[model samples]
Target: MMRSHRLFLIAMVAILATVLFRVPAKADYYGEPAELVDRATSVYKGFLADPNLEWFRNNVGSARGILIVPQMLRGGFIIGGSGGRGLLVAQDAATNKWSSPAFYSMGSVSVGFQIGADVSEIILLIMTDRGLDAMLSTDYKIGADVAIAAGPIGGSAKAQTADILAFGRSQGAYGGVSLEGAAISPLVDWNARYYGQPVQIFDILINQKWNNRQADSLRQLLPKPRRNAQPLGR
Candidate 1:
């Protein structure tokens, strides 16, 4: 009887330990910024590899900033939500150089006829100062703060003169994808973790605060700003 009781107690403790260990930590919820940067690099490379994205490649040179969401998940039975984390990089008008990435989270809730889920890679080209300014804010709504248009696909496609242009590469059959009411907010914790200190969006992007060697490769992937061309919204 004594032996059986001891065995039962041991099993209970073992089960409890397993359960506790399986639970993810809070930091795990937000991925490491370095890993996110590498993933963003791959996502951008994938975009460039797509023959249908020639228009994007051509017009990207004119963008004031670029936001890359490597993997955004969306699903719903009726009332659904979509959310994801991404990196945003801006171009310095004076020096024609790209800035360090600013981390952000985007989420939205919708009520409609939606059933299935889809995973997609999203890219937003900030076409004007207005669009870039809105993204630099602490929190901003997509369509309300800055106008967003679906990016044109294919070689001969021409993008419209909008504040922002959005492109998506979906993995599953989602009926439709929209950024109409989505909210974008800065991820301060992730930025702090990456930079080893608390930093503001303006400090990292505009003022050029800390620098990480890991970002050198990623910065090289961006389109170089034209020296003769004037900055947008000048």
Candidate 2:
């Protein structure tokens, strides 16, 4: 039991070090937030087209918002770590139109085991107003602020009360993941750079005016929601 606890602590430290030291040193406008928007668009399109993700496709009409993480890496016992940055866009309750994406980073140390590595593309569907509010906040803990669960794959799955439903497509020796205690925070600078002005999550998601032309294609992809929501994805 002590050994397991030690491993978890080590994992958290590695993740913290990487987020603190490695990310900001990048030149080129910190790798350009526009590039992330492009990647997010592709990821969203792929999920919609994937046949294996039937539940997501069928039930997406009920989601209040969607977050797309183009890549999430998990590896190593020592010189390795796990983290990913993503974007969130919510549907306007009044207009029923999708808003522009807001930049966010998500990280977790509790993915995979002591050995091996994996990479995944993840999509999260926010099911309620509370879930959407959490995403709009500067910082959010997955299972603490609201519940989150792995979205079902096949048809037999029933509805879920969780605030967020996560879907991941992974590859590598250690292939699966869980977001139970993951930390998510807004990428404030990235959001400013991406839109050519500083903006808050409320402006980007709720008021729905903080937008960029590059993201229009991505917003156009989301389905229109129903007047009523169902427990399944609503």
Candidate 3:
């Protein structure tokens, strides 16, 4: 009887600790680091190649810099399981090289008992000068002071040729959800591993160093920007 009581106490303590302090498990899809890196790089290059992406990148290039979060976050019903990390690489305007990429994680909670997963790539283009400035700080909250908008639809890429811009918004899985109320921060550890260089999140995303690489890559992959031949203006 005493042993049973002691075991119950231990189980309770474990449950409390899990709830109070929990870090999402590291994402290692297919257990291949090189494959993951290649996947991420390809996704970014694909965006650069898309004609619509070219106009979007150009319009936002005027911002102090851009913040890109390539995400894959999953969650479900009663079990409440979730975990996925992403890389955010900033481009430098003067140097034309990509800054080391930073890491970030995504989390969500729900009640029902639905079990499913989504795999997608995402990028947040900081369009305004003010948007980049605020994010450069140690900690920034979305929707509080920053102005954000839903990213353009891949299908409507042609329709949005005019370079309409907005603050940081999400792309990828469960599309159309706003990241306005989300908490985004820079990842110090990831930058060190991926680039073999020390970097802070703000330095990569806000400063203009890596910005140039992104701009140049897009330009090379896409046609020069031009006005929309078929105006939806009317």
Q: Report the C-alpha lDDT of model 2 over 1-234, residue by residue, as the tens digit.
A: 999999999998887576445532321122777788888888888877776666787878788889888887666644445678888988877788888888888876653346556667888889889888888777788888687888876656656667899888875211124787778899899999888888888998889888788988887888887667665532
Candidate 3, residues 1-234, lDDT tens digits: the string is: 999999998996776455324424433342332344445566656665565454454544333333433444544423444444555444444444445445554444445655454444555654444565555555555655665665564544442321113322234222333554455555456555544567666655555233323234433432222233232211
Better of 2 and 3 by TM-score: 2
List the global CA lDDT of all models.
0.78, 0.76, 0.46
TM-score of each: 0.82, 0.81, 0.55
RMSD of each: 8.0, 6.2, 7.3
What lDDT score goes with residue 232 in model 2?
Answer: 52
The true-versus-predicted C-alpha distance at residue 63 of model 2, in Å, is 0.9
Instruction: After superposing candidate 1 on the true structure, give the runs of residues whose Cα lies further than 4 Å from its correct spot.
Output: 1-30, 172-177, 228-234
Q: Give the TM-score of candidate 3.
A: 0.55
Error of 2 at 11 (Å): 18
lDDT of 2 at 6: 100
Error of 3 at 107 (Å): 3.9
Top candidate, metric lDDT: 1
- Candidate 3 lDDT: 0.46
lDDT of 1 by residue, 1-234 (tens): 999999998996775454333321211244588988998999888887788888787778788889998877676554556778899988887777888898998877777866666667889988898998899888899988567788888777755667888889887221123688889999999989888999989988887876777888889989886566543332
